[model samples]
Target chain A: MRIETKTEKFDEPLHLESGRILESFELVYETYGELNEDKSNVIVICHALAGSHHAAGRYANEAKPGWWDKFIGDGKVIDTTKYFVICSNNIGSTFGSTNPLSIDPSTGKEYRFKFPILTISDVVRAQMKLYDRLGIEKAVAVIGGSMGGMQALCYSIEQPDFTDTVIAMATTAYTRPWAIAINKIAIESIRHDPAFKDGFYDPDDLQAQGLPGLAIGRMAGLIAYLSPELFNSKFGREYARTDGLYELFGRFEVERYLEYNSYSFPKVFDPLSYLYICKTMNIFDAGRNKDKLEDSFDKVKCNLHLISFKDDMLFFPEEMEEIRDIMIKLGKQDQITYKMVDSQSGHDSFLVEVEKFEDHVRDILKGK
Target chain B: MRIETKTEKFDEPLHLESGRILESFELVYETYGELNEDKSNVIVICHALAGSHHAAGRYANEAKPGWWDKFIGDGKVIDTTKYFVICSNNIGSTFGSTNPLSIDPSTGKEYRFKFPILTISDVVRAQMKLYDRLGIEKAVAVIGGSMGGMQALCYSIEQPDFTDTVIAMATTAYTRPWAIAINKIAIESIRHDPAFKDGFYDPDDLQAQGLPGLAIGRMAGLIAYLSPELFNSKFGREYARTDGLYELFGRFEVERYLEYNSYSFPKVFDPLSYLYICKTMNIFDAGRNKDKLEDSFDKVKCNLHLISFKDDMLFFPEEMEEIRDIMIKLGKQDQITYKMVDSQSGHDSFLVEVEKFEDHVRDILKGK
Candidate 1:
């Protein structure tokens, strides 16, 4: 299916959780299929870290489809033929959104480090305003995975009556200490790179010299997103070059794969945006003001579906089990459905193993 | 329990598997007790990556005891009272050994990258020469954990007639791809730091400007050494400062702990040594030339004991189980014993949870 992008500019400033305001911003988004007369057929799809507004289909000049192309087409699991699928780039994202890379109207220079820090709730609020402009009173469902899953949960809780259903995959309501620790190291890698220049380097020089730090950060993140079983099966101890044990630069296939990913990421993503999003993810807490997790979930009125991967080390399956148990204790077990998918993809199963949960996703959407 | 360090300089060139040679090198070691007649009670302990020759007691002005001081006291599990305990700093380590920080006699300058790349086997070979100089024909046992465990396994396989028992904990016969990937990123972090200057930076400047990269690398390594349960129990989501969510520099307790470790590690450790040792660890494979793992263990003549932690993500329990299963298939099960310790300390369990296996360690040592 062919896809077209659209943008809307909001002149009013956005009040952020950090008490800072984004003067004026633009939202880049894409729409698949037709919206019903009452706008009741709208299904909002949230993107994960490093993702964009392009949720599915191919553009005229693009070589590949969107990140979720496999599961969000006309006849796919999300089925654009039945519902209006809307995906917007989050405010702090680099992909055509009003991010740190955007020019500051006041100084006529890129925001960079001057950009205000954001939260997961702040990103959700920006999208909600976009929905209001598009005449969408409420979404049929919000579907997401990983960091996107965090946004879906935020929408369900903060905008309790805004969405009818919420589907979160491979994520937790609160940022885990283990996950935060890993992210902190990734951020430090970027900060320590001399070429980063405190996030003030020339845009052209950023990709060239700043790559070492960006690539290293991405490599660490990629390892966390994958399982040991997958790495062993795919790469093992195979050498990229064949001088054997004595070669200084002899590379493992796994190392080569990681390097390729690290090298390619900086070409498209902005470093400052990566840092901002990571900070937002680190501070996410559904029970920020509440004493108990159940108290936080008590305010979530949407029918909930939480799916976890068995081998996911970043967001363990036990966390989802705890969320389920909490809902049970609150006498709302009937309103939630929890499933653990047996997968070796780790936290990335939500994106890579879509076929494993195609029927379940279909059933959940059908209920809405 | 008052230990003293000793150095043995071997004038003869040491040959390495990497086809490089060290013209002359020194091995720094510590002894806890007297060597009995016939050297029948000698126990050689191999130190892990980044560890020093100081293995059991405290020095005159030292603020802390040795890394394994808790487990190697007079009446502890290893029982220094009954055994002569010797722990040597590996050649590539930053400690008082011939590492990259050592001056080259020919140039009067630090070897830096000019130093020969050493392997785990080379380190074991150097320790063997130390034993020869001490007039010890064989050791009662060789015990180590993590990289030390790798050295212990190498001692048993390569020097079958030299040791009677091998205690390998939180390690595998071969390096796993998952571990190599993590180490690859750690090395990249240091290399990307402009202050590193291709490993040619002055020592003073290195400690000042090169700290960011070193600290980030150490932080990444420290996270892998710990388990998720330990992080949650120890830190959770408590903030280091009380500005709540709005403060940009506000850190979680876990983040603060990692930062402290990263900062302090660079004070004594050398980055070049870290890179070299990590390289040695990444390329370690007992079955290097052999087609099957069982072939590698076929030459093993010493009784082997392999211990794995349930929470070790670096060296998963499955890897240790594979070693045991391979031995069982070779009908050498009688020569091998395997145990999986239940602990949330991850790979650090070998050092932190010594009490959990105190009796087992005592019994294994008594067997000799």
Candidate 2:
């Protein structure tokens, strides 16, 4: 199974949910395995915030595989051999996509804050266009977790007759207030960074400014990604190496862990992209109205599988149950299934602890 | 009952657990009721981080009373008529205490980052000194919640005979990695603010700088102080007052609520004090070693009452149960009582929803 990435350019304008337009853009995507006749074996995988189109396998020199490598490799649960996998860099994402950091051809300047707000529906629509270019008449299934899960939900509603199945894991049908509140900390941190200069700072100068604001925002986001149980078990009350607890800038092992994971994140990620993506996540409302549950799911033709992690405080398992209940109320209980994996990794379980649900996912992908 | 706040100066240097000293400081405290014969009815109340000595009563022109006004009034739970209550502003708090923003007598400049890191023991010792100044041999009880709860636990062990009872609520015996991780977010937020100026910025210029970092930090802190259920029920998916969710810097009702509470927090709070106090909390361990629980409570003479909020995610109820379990293992089951109040206010229940535990507090104070 050869793994390769290619860019597909579209000269046609993309009308966004915000009523803004992307005059022209490129979608960088990766494909694994071979597309069978008619391309009906295709499985489109959506990536979460901070993720990329490189969903599986490693590059020539990289130490780690892609974000969901363990779950999507040749003989893994997702089984690339059995399904042709396609993953695209989301439009507002920093990874090789036409994001906020991309230069505007008309003005020869980075879009930055000028990047229009995006929604899950907009992201899904762009991927559908990529599918059109790839000659994929319809995907066998659309699979995702977290923000990617939001995109999966969008795929079901936006193109009800396209895919046969939709798998959304560790996410909400709609973003909750708790999640929005957490996003505010990150936005405020970046907005307050003196070096941010209203998102117009030279990319070259970010290293000198330490991107302190972006690092802080990443740190805040990291807290929500993992759970308190994981933190206590892994780094309980431990002091940072070679530092007394009373020393200036002294850190607990947990603080050191956060700084290690987030401090250099700005060098690899775009702050404006982060800000924009968070706004998209904040406004996500798949089942737009609970009172009109039937209307909300009226267009759905795919079999829906809503997978949740029990300990995920960010998205919360109950919120997913709310979606199942809505479908049940609409007399679509037979069309939808909800599974909660007993996990302590919080929302990160879908990526790092996929073993917990690997068998179930394999079965679902098999339509068993 | 009448309430008055007065400052008591101490020429003696205060030794800290960090092996540092606060030389010749003032302890500002508010008192209610009268000292009885032998001065035995004194109830020393401890304040948490961001708290003040003003525990009860309002000024002539003020619209609201003190932080714990409901629980500490003349006929309230603590019952000032029967117990003379004393609440002191912690040394490193932003209130009227000798904090980091206070002038250093030696240099005639603000202490700023020069303030020594404090522990719950140091705070407890300082309050005991105030007792010595008033010629009081001991207090009837030491009561507090959250970080103040840390102090109540400290009083039981630090000065076994200083008080006959210790009521610690919505707090942990030691700060968990989970909590240290959250405090890290706040510290990072404040530290990254360019206006922070290495904690050397002019206090007069903070307002002009907008104190963005402090506001960001406070916003993060506010999240843990509340539970998800409260956020969901109160704000849900409501749009802000005027702007729709798609507007620039557009916000959900919950984000608006957080902004309203945290945006102006820096104007009234000192960032340096916040940094110093968080360090104290991160290192707090009342029962120093689980294996040597006996040693930690060896000289403890007070009856300990540990109260917890059911929804407290910050200082979890299980952590409080761990303390009680330790006491039970030490064969002191009869000496300690644990109470869990069902509430959705999280760690803030100890401050805002004390009504749920008022009867219990009154009974415990009455030795019932």
Candidate 3:
């Protein structure tokens, strides 16, 4: 029931689709629950743009609960009692994993932008290798929300024989137009961040410039993650401080909330890692496989569950329906279940609206 | 009918709501169209953040069309052919007007962030001084969009006798939660910009620091101005150089669009301007008049026209209807018209889809 870490070097080079080769890289991952003797209970949870391998439970007394801590506890849909779970920080992530901030073996310096433009498939491929190393022949399911959903879909298709159940939440098979634009803006914000300095500034010197920029960039993601109504209700023109003698000092509560969100990030996340994950998310479109969506779905060999939210503007529920229909056309209707969760948490319902989302996960974990 | 310039200086210190005083200040403005013999044709146009006195007509041979040129042309709404028009750059804006960027007469240094916080009503009060200098006693209408719309609403309530008719377009009556969040991010981005150097770095030193940070901040605005559908339809998965190539290069049309926008701005806008304008906009809320919505509208002297774009997620059209309903309850129903323009351009339709907006203007200006 506790998350465990594993570290290893890739036996060979990670040949990215761009023809760039990253040689003999180290990967760090963590697994939760217990791997059944047959390893059939394996369920992989992919994290979002800023998430890490810590999807549930605590590693140390000082560490906070996992990213989806609310929904992944005992008796939850992703029950530790019934299933073995694995969550790996993406290769280009900063969480206990090799990423741009990781020291390069050749130069002993952080790779930074020298890190290859990573694709979601590349991350999935690395995860597959980890599965192979762990003796997990085929998983009962692979599930994730947002970028994690992207990986789940990619894994279900590219290596379908390895994953028999795929649940993609608050995501699309391919990066949509608006999502792509938002991704590009986030990247541009990171690149143009003066401290970025073409991604070559000294790590020590880069902190001051890059950290604040990263905070603002993360706040941008926060906007898409939460509902505007929620923001209004919470912040609603409320002032944080009063000048005493007939005056308003602080801004509405929402302004303070966004500031808190932006500032808290630079203290935790690396700017380069933020950029890498965003880039991988933007390039993740299963429909890009063989220039057709069906060709991509044709490779999926799983009981698929496409879960979406009514007010999730970033990842439209309609997009999930399209993916569900594709699975049905592939004659996997009985194996695939599609449900639109009515929630106003925007695209972040999977992480916050645990009561409802947990039920969906339970249905899948129970194989109902 | 030609746009004419006028200037006036405050005889005493102007007291701001924030309890700060701006001592001995000047206001500059331009008038388009013509005033009727009774001066009843006067219609004032308030500009958005960073907008200017050059709201219509050419100022110089190479001058680009004014920001609202599409809305204030010969045959356009607020037409020069009939109603007299007056447009002024706000008191703290950087466009041919007195602002934080202006040299302080006392120390000969730019005010920078030292400029006191200004409210929407304060801006209208400054514009009113320009009218007094031009010998115009009152305006028949007050019209604007975004921050300009906030000023228009403020004028209708704060100075109803001078602003007989009001038109607030593509904007909300108050600084909604989302607007506050965007402004917070923008301000935070500028503060993090090293070239800003706590708002004291030499302008020359900003080329390496302030410009890029400002560019990134502006890019966020570009995303809100356009709709997601427009972005997808125009640049869905189209790549430049090849598929999945991620770098600073523009692979998708939307990338090129955003890149062009980001680069084009830093050349003209200063980091301080970005900070100041964002602060001014975030503090804008006309409904704050005596802390009662009805009390605010009771001061309005004439008809009201509120136009919103249905697809404007940044400033939802539903918020506009809510505002219109407030006007109706104030016994102005017969004089008020609430309409939503169906467009996929989102908040940018006021500039992009001008033809469709012209009809609404015709209805408002016909009697004059």
Candidate 4:
């Protein structure tokens, strides 16, 4: 189970377009490194779907280091010893963040399924507002992977003056048709479950029904997160548990892994939050601007570094090539560099592959 | 809808292990070409999962040619003019073959779920019995794909004198952990349905609960049969239909295609046969002879041709390479040739790709 934390004092409430006031929502964040005297060396790291604010180091007695622990710390990439790093859970997230599960003023009940949908820009704007309230004028660099990569691109385009450099890895400016299809199926699996009750089910009534459908959906997601070659090599025709039950039932290790991961999610996550994050991601597309590649990519002004994996079936290398070609065609080649890494870990390589990824980040920071 | 035709008749009654004699089991067969003087130029082709007796050519009233028509008709690779070809629906198949729907002798009621679980060897033996009754001493070739390929391999190993050449395309000597996992999950989907009742549900009881489960299972099966690249190229996030009913519903063409195919399967297929065929395929491992690679390869006297696809993710090309290396080690390199075709269709390429596959077969037949 995940522990939700709230700050006792908030500077002010946020005013929304609906004329509703969100009174003092806390920003769930995990920080590393001390802020420099000039405060000019702060870097913000965004996370992907289902990722929390815990970006590095052990957090609140957790056994494992945070998600990107390898890339942060005393003398690593970004040199935590020299740079202040602020990573926050998105506003629409469930992990100690002010998501639908937070108490709603309108009814004095948890938002549950009543939270309005959010866009990537909505998330970025909220984070920017938080930074402004905290007296941070700009980030030396903004970086993310997958959904986080998406947030970085959005920030670079929408708030160019606040970020000097942007790094987007194992992600896209927009969700492609294939990615959209995959997300759509996963959402359907969750929503179509009878237990979902149109996303308004009682929290106490959640059952295995919604879990299995969601599990199967996550299994599909896991496939996209992995390369076909890796799957063939590691789990090909291999049983997860070699007891006699497998011979009678035909179970594989990957299937067991997927099932365990999916079931374990609800223990810490709210179902409504899962739905909201996926929906936010579905509407995320960088190619939506002007319906042309040049106009869309031309809108971004941040010094950009784009990276992809050669074996990422979910985000094909060709998409990155297209992005690079567009930046070049738009006469921004000098401002951008594209690197395709060779890894069989697939899209998840962004998190799993740290040394090589940090080295690329350091080289970019050195302006090489 | 596919039309089922019961044409060929078996004269002898067969005794079952169930202590009952089956009066008359019909052989649903499709034939190509005319028999030569000694009837030694006959080739028997077996159908794989969901396949039927119509291996090639169009039926009189149908517009579409048989599934394998492109590679098996006159002037084609399995040239009907040169060698007589016979294709049969396996005993446990629902496509006009003796299956669960067949009447039981004791109760005079449709066996329905009473059908015994079958093995690959059992299916092969049934075909041999059919061949013996047909008065054919030997076949010029025995060829099949996927599950059919398993039957071909079993036939050559169990009765080498009956076959001169064996073509096993896109198949495995044993079911790997991955394949079994996929098959079991599919079966579980069917079994968990309320209407299944341990496969005792009435066939006439349409709109059964198992249909949805079967549809999802088939969708899973279809994804396994396709490559990520093929799906990416064909279905990438192009939305065909959108209703306010759900946000993350299908937004891509391929997801829609998979759902469409799965929905169509229930109109014709019996759920029990699907279970039986899957079980048979899972336990099929011809390499269990546990002999040395050379000894095992040398045990098969028939000429062998193994063809694989580069993108066939289900049966990896590496597996085929292993089989090829073993054949060469046995000094059968002169008699056995291996070919890997480039196709984006994945495992289904053996049926979808014709020109290249047919050319390879023709060259092999001409002793090239």
Which portions of model 3 show Cα errors greater than 4 Å?
A103-110, A193-197, A201-210, A242-252, A289-291, A325-335, B10-13, B105-109, B203-210, B241-251, B289-291
Instruction: Give the local distance difference test score of model 3.
Output: 0.76
Candidate 1 is scored at a TM of 0.97
Top lDDT: which candidate number? 2
Provide the fnat value for model 4, as a fraction from 0 to 1.
0.19
Any runs in candidate 2 off by more than 4 Å, and if so which? A105-108, A207-209, B105-108, B207-209, B289-291
CA lDDT scores, all candidates in order: 0.85, 0.86, 0.76, 0.72
Question: What does candidate 3 score on TM?
Answer: 0.92
Candidate 2, position B135, lDDT: 94
lDDT measured at residue A64 in model 4 versus the true structure, 0 to 100: 82
Q: What TM-scores do the predictions have?
A: 0.97, 0.97, 0.92, 0.84
Residue by residue across A294-350, what tens digits does model 4's lDDT show? 776778788888998887866777776777888899899887889988887889888
DockQ of each: 0.71, 0.76, 0.49, 0.26
Collision pairs in model 1: none
Clashes per model (N, Cα, C within 3 A): 0, 0, 2, 9
Highest DockQ scorer = 2
Error of 2 at B15 (Å): 1.9
Q: Per-residue CA lDDT of candidate 2, range A305-364, in tens?
A: 999998897999998898888788878888899999999898899998988999988888
lDDT of 4 by residue, B236-259 (tens): 545566633124342346656876
